[model samples]
Target chain A: MKKIIMEKEAGRFCENKDIAKKLREEIIEPTIREKEPVIIDFGNVSGATQSFIHALVSNVIREYRDQAFDNLLYKNACLEIQKIISIVYNYMQLD
Target chain B: MDEKWVNVNPAQLALTAALALKVGKENAIIQSQNIPLSARYLDRMGLYNFFSTPSPFRQYRKKEPAGRFVPISIIKNGDDQSKFVTDIIPLYHLSEKNSRILSYIVGELVRNVLEHSFSEDGAVVAAQYYKESNRISFAICDTGIGLWKSLQIWHPKTDKEALSLALTPGVTGTTLELGGTSENGGAGLFFIKSIVKISRSYFVIMSGDSEYTLLKTRPDIKNRLYSDPFKDHYAFSNSISRFNGTLVAVDLKLDSTPEFQKLLDDIGDIYDSAVKESRRKPARKPKFI
Candidate 1:
């Protein structure tokens, strides 16, 4: 039941697929292994380019698509950022 | 008095410069760096004119040079403009070097206005016709979300300091992946500064709140020293608005030849591309009108 919270950056948010990939390896991989829930924060991190958000969110959704879903969750994504991610998630068929 | 505006949202200032050269009064070719001119635009020597056309203004394409001052403007909208100057350069009988110089200057001006900008009026353009010698000037004005608005994104500093950084290559306001600033680090305008130093044509640039004018001090071209000030004054418009419209000024020499005359269409393409770059509702060049 470890709650991992990744803080948000300014409006720019984090970019580069490499960063997203690294987070996948360290955070998502371990969380799934232990079946613990993860909550990422977007309190300060305002929003990010469509491409950057796509890279990160898609990765998590695909990895835990069907089996033991809802084990990992993203919390605190700004209203704008969350809205965009939700739209993209549906577009990606992760609903 | 008989000359009427023949454009459909010309590329702002480039078309104006070409038309100025084609005016066929003094038969002089002129060029201006890519930057917005003040509201003063094209007023000079009891001659005042304004409009925005296409660049690389040519009076005659093959034989004799074009007329005195061919009015040209950019007829554009926003950033992401792909070297439309390429289409117009060949007609000028300019070497790659010459084409690069003109395009580079224009690139600097147009890119800045397009990338870091926001305007309530959509886009802005203006040119002046110098009645006496028929030197129609080119200029585009915008309420750019000024350098300060841009800097607010990352840095904290004075408007002047922000402006200085603006020309510092790669110093654009566009976010990454959105084809952010200066692919080569926003060096477009910076490179223009040096090339202009060697040009025998009139070159001036005013970005953000800073102004750089070079009329008399230019390198020799074809053993001819080119230096003529179209206008040396700051222009302000919608001073209260956040605009990024940029004005370009240049007096082109349109040699009396049909080839140069044909350039009107070439300039047309440049304007067409502006609409695409800015991602605005597609618009046509003023020429067809």
Candidate 2:
């Protein structure tokens, strides 16, 4: 299992699309390919935009389909972050 | 065409010059008592170069500067874009919650330029905090393919119709990939509109050859579209204009937590109702036709 700390990767503001892409590529994609469970740790990150969460989580859901749920873990997400993640995840499922 | 000097408000003059330059009408040769002043202001802000000769009182232009009212800044790429939201907005002395709301509103508008404007020179952002008026005004502008051209991929639309669809949630002009930095949900303007609607913001979107303005007043009626009580706030207009690309301007009341929270709660309620409705509807059995 690989633990990816979002605050370390994207700093305090995890709201940029390109930064989200870098996070997805560096951590999520590689871990998912190895069929290893990846823990996305949002320990100190403050807030995120829908676009950023969409890039980080939905793109993977698009690639791995339903299996993304099994291979990924969200850790230490604040209430706001959890809400955004749920919105993006649910929106992606609609598509 | 004839050249004439028109008397207009300073802000209107600025918008006229900016729109003229945006639509490739820089050489139209019309002037105003305030147009020259507006020109000098835009020139300093790096918005338009409508004037060939510098203002006579160049020292005043330099000493006072245009940022007094219109704090204009150009955002070229992603780095400036992020810094503008996370860093610059907090300097205005707003509450944390207010900062977040402004950040979301401004971020969404500017992100639209990054994702869809496709302008070579990038987008321009301008904002003003009117302390006396208890409001903040700002605009995000781009010189790329206009809304009509972008949404033509989905279907042919007049500039007015394009503005309508752009404000409608789940409607996108292009087939953007599901996710990856780009704004994929097509909810940028929709969210901003809802925010403005709740916060009693005066909002305007100018693109192609049409402009749309929504003015909020007397909080009586619900905004049917967003399911929020934006009632008695129904000063909406769709007019013909010659602006190219897209320009979104907003003047929202400062510190509107109640309105903003109501918007969020409304969205959550709608989402819950949708899920419950979907669960209630039974799946249909497959039948040969």
Candidate 1 regions with alpha-carbon error over 4 angstroms: A1-95, B1-74, B77-87, B120-140, B154-156, B174-184, B200-203, B207-209, B214-289
Give lDDT tens digits, candidate 1, residues A1-95: 54444442212333233444556667766777677776666666534433345445555555566432477566776554555455435433412
- The TM-score of candidate 1 is 0.35
TM of each candidate vs. truth: 0.35, 0.78
Which segments of candidate 2 are over 4 A away from where they belong? B1-51, B60-70, B176-183, B222-239, B259-262, B271-289
lDDT of 2 by residue, B19-120 (tens): 544555445444444454434444554444443434344555353433234445667777888888766776776776677777777767777888788876
Candidate 1 falls in which docking quality class? incorrect
lDDT digits (tens) for residues B1-289 of candidate 1: 1133222222334333333433432544333454232222232211123323232333323322122222333334422123233333344454433333344344445544554555333223333333454322334445445566765654736544554454342234544212232121233343343233333234344444454444434233222111111221223222222223233344322211112112222222322232223323357757864
- Please name the candidate that would achieve the greatest lDDT relative to the true structure: 2
